[model samples]
Target: MKSNIIRSVLSATALGVLSSSAMAHGDEEHAKPRTFDASKVEATAFGQEGNPKKVSRVIHVGMSDHMRFSPATISVKRGETVKLVVRNDGQILHEMVLGTKEALKEHAELMKKFPEMEHADSNMAHVKPGKAGEIIWQFTKAGEFEFACLQPGHFEAGMVGKVLVK
Candidate 1:
């Protein structure tokens, strides 16, 4: 009877852990509420959060276990809003985080320090394996911007991309 009770407790604990993570993936809501405020989003060195209704074009990017983003070089016209559809074709978790080269390097280092940190922002899309995510952004300036999978050592593995706003 004691063995049975112990097994039940262990099984319950495992299920709880899985259920919590499952809540953040697929079509399920995030484990924590996303406090993204579209209206309050401000313009950054790269751009600003775009209005879904104003997206002028759609770009599809594929992330793979090889630590690379297909079509890593992207081009966009200034003042245009783009619907960036990021699909993870790998068997592991990945994310697309848009920022300047300097910022990306800093963030990547932070991720290395805290591997289990959960980061959610308007300029980021965390995707599970075989799943997808989206980030709508408006290129309000004409400059270069960088993006990478800031997942621990993923960035160091060279999972990065670039956007040329002209």
Candidate 2:
């Protein structure tokens, strides 16, 4: 009888979480799966997803357990298509999400509120420890952008970077 009650509570909690959209947690499979729709991709304030075939250059980024990203600041040319190869060298999960500082901060707050929120978007790459992920994007607009790991306390711990597009 006790086991049955526990199961019921757990199921309810899971359902509640699933009902809302949450940030990705750097897992192979998200609780709420979201597939990338290349056909529907559009330009945004940051940029739009790039064509892998049109990649102008590739940049490698490393994420570590120390709450840091190697070569935090990146430079790119406006309208250039770049392939970001992100690797996780740490033992824990880490993600790289590109956006404006304000957007990142708001998303980070949401992540803190829902630690298990599952999210997947073209602008973000959720990498597992010792594994690699990639994000191909075109810097359509010329401005300064930011990237950070919004995993629970990761962002608050200063895991952030800059992207300058000229």
Candidate 3:
């Protein structure tokens, strides 16, 4: 009986979050997921690819409320194609945009200006509340990068993470 009550609460909470995020990205253009130009994203940055054999590892990331990402930092090998499976466990819209620290900072600023930015890039996976998304990309070079939610105030709220490709 106790477990049932808890499950009901959880379901309601998840529904509330999805509803809010849907409203935020209500326009069909923003709600529908689309792929963008990975070539222009940056050479050092991870780019999306379909090389399944190249995928050396699968990483599961969780985005939740309080502007947090579980396992804040991830590591990968150079020349490795990693599968990033990100899930939004919170009751809001969230995303994982991968890039260098500087690039992320710049992009975050741009997000503030264009809160409704739509994207479809291999290096980015935006998930709605209670939904899961994936990004399969190869780390072409060894370096540091970041992933964060570009949803309006999410980045500012500290929803960011680091990726170290060595």
- Among all candidates shown, the one with the greatest lDDT: 2
User: After best superposition, candidate 2 residue 132: deviation in angstroms?
Assistant: 0.4
* lDDT for 52 (candidate 3): 51
The regions of model 2 sitting more than 4 angstroms off are 1-17, 20-38
Off by over 4 Å in 1: 1-38
Q: Residue by residue across 76-108, what tens digits does model 3's lDDT show?
A: 887888888999899877888887776677667
lDDT for 4 in candidate 1 is 60
List the candidates' TM-scores in order: 0.79, 0.81, 0.73
Best by TM-score: 2
Judging by lDDT, tell me the better candidate of 1 and 3. 1
1-166: candidate 1 lDDT, tens digit per residue: 6446544644564456455643242333323423546779888788999888889999999999999999899999999999999999999888899988977786786566545454467888888889888998999999999999988778999999999999
The C-alpha local distance difference test score for the whole of candidate 3 amounts to: 0.72
lDDT by residue (1-166, candidate 2, tens digit) is 6446544654565467668765345565542323446798887788998887789999999999999999899999999999999999999989999988877887787676667776667888888889888888899999999999999999999999999999
Question: Who is ahead in TM-score, 1 or 2?
Answer: 2
Question: lDDT values of the candidates?
Answer: 0.80, 0.83, 0.72
**Candidate 3 similarity to native, TM-score:** 0.73
